[model samples]
Target: MHRPAVIALHYQNDILHPDGLIRVGLSEDDQKRTQLLVAAKKMLDGARAHGWPIIHVRVAYRHDYADLIQNAPILKSVANIGAVKEGSWGSDFYQALAPREDCFNEHVVTHKRINPFYDTQLCVLLRGLNIERVLIAGVATHSVVESTARHAVDCGFHVTVAADACASASSESHNHSLNSMRLIAEVSDVQSTLEALK
Candidate 1:
């Protein structure tokens, strides 16, 4: 059996919280689409119950924004909004979806880019754990989730995405990303992923 780790990507307040800075720009319907805390909580519980390694991936930049690359439109918007600064509340993981201390050797990986694997120690950590497969759940399904899943496949790790545990700016974008990822990764809901892990 493949040893799988659960990588929860970018559950930061700036992205998922109701009062997040980015929320100021999102539509009400978009806000509704981001109601992922409950589903993420369930996924975490299942992963913990099965003793699967849980990795939390967050994106945060230096206080002076020196480490931030504003090449991308989304990143430029992030800088303009003053979101996700290191040590800021907006950069912290959403409380309910945070990894518990008792969770199976929980790991936290910070990245400055959308793809968690880029310029981060995520792959090294997974390799150290002998992880052969990864189950991903996170916010902005069309961005981080899709980017990371594609990179994971290139890195020779089997990927599974917990569909219900991921959210995006809107349902259409979310589903579109999921459909695209289906070509290279297994797409399953939280319950199905949990059951398979069990």
Candidate 2:
């Protein structure tokens, strides 16, 4: 069996917290659904129990925003709102989903772009840990989650996305992205994922 790892993406204050910088743009229902902290915690615990590495990924930019890419609408929104600056609380991992200090080989990977693999040490870390399959869970299903899933598939890792642990700005976008990811990755829920890890 391929060694598995859980890649929790973009579980940052700017995206998951109610008092987050971008929370105003999310619908009430979306905000409720975006509360993946509990589900992510469960997944992380399960992964640890199974001896799988847990990789927490977040997006953060320089305080000066010099490294940020504002070419796209989403990027522009992030820049305009001053979200996820390197030294700011908005860039910190969500409190409930933060990585545990006791877990061996657990990693906190930071990326400058939407895809966690882009110009990041994520691939290297996975390779060092001999990770061949990835279980992904995070916010904005249509963006970071989907982007990372597709990239993982392209990089030759078997990918599974925890459907219930991911949320978007709207239900429509979330479902749509999940359907799209289904074509390339296994789409599952947190319980099913935990069972598989065992």
RMSD of each: 2.0, 1.8
Q: What is the lDDT of candidate 1?
A: 0.86
lDDT for each of the candidates?
Answer: 0.86, 0.85
1-198, model 1: which lDDT tens digit per residue? 866899999887887777887743344455444446667888888888788899999989988899998999999998998999999999998888887877657999999988989888999999999999999988788999999999999999999999988877677998999999999999999888888877
lDDT of 2 at 197: 63
Question: Which tens-of-lDDT digit does each residue in 67-176 have in candidate 2?
Answer: 99788898898888889999899999888888878877689999988888999899998888888899998888999999999999999999999988888777788899
| TM-score for candidate 1, residues paired by index | 0.93
Q: Which whole-number lDDT from 0 to 100 does residue 59 have in model 2?
A: 89
Give the winner by lDDT. 1
The positional error of residue 164 in candidate 2, measured at the CA in angstroms, is 0.5
